[model samples]
Target: MAITKIVELVGESKDNWRDAAANAVKEANKTIDEITGVEILNLTADVKDGEIIEYKANVQVAFPVREQRK
Candidate 1:
């Protein structure tokens, strides 16, 4: 049997939403494995001095569930 798991992660980038999403996946991959896909849930931006400084992205990462063995 195969199981799946989903997790929400937030990533920010000075570039764009795409980079932010990619950053999320890359960061998650540092600790997770078998990453199937990433879904962008929401997008926002931070402004400083009347200019956009950073882009924020909310992402959902899905991967295969890993079971522990005894």
Candidate 2:
């Protein structure tokens, strides 16, 4: 049998929402293995002087469950 798990993550970037989403996946890739997919939940940004100062992405990251060996 195979199993997968999902975790929510928020990523921030000064560039854009797309970069913010990519950042989320990049961060997850650091600690997570065999990342199967990603679902973008929400996109928001911080505004300053009527300009976007930062982008934030809410995402669901999915990865497979594996047995640990010691």
**Candidate 1 lDDT by residue in tens digits, 1-70:** 7788999999999999999999999999999999999899999999999999999999999999878747
C-alpha lDDT of all candidate models, in order: 0.95, 0.95
Q: For residues 1-70, write the lDDT of model 2, one tens digit per residue.
A: 6788999999999999999999999999999999999999999999999999999999999998986637
What C-alpha lDDT, on a 0 to 100 scale, does residue 31 get in candidate 2?
98
Worst 10 residues of 1 by lDDT: 61-70
Which residue pairs collide, candidate 2? none
Q: After aligning candidate 2 to the native by TM-score, how far in Å is the CA of 30 from where it should be?
A: 0.6
Per-candidate count of clashing residue pairs (backbone under 3 Å): 0, 0
Against the true structure, what is each candidate's TM-score?
0.91, 0.90
Q: Output the lDDT of residue 62, model 1.
A: 95
Model 2 scores a TM of 0.90
Q: What value of lDDT does candidate 1 attain over all alpha carbons?
A: 0.95
Q: After superposition, how far is residue 33 of candidate 1 from its true place, in Å?
A: 0.7
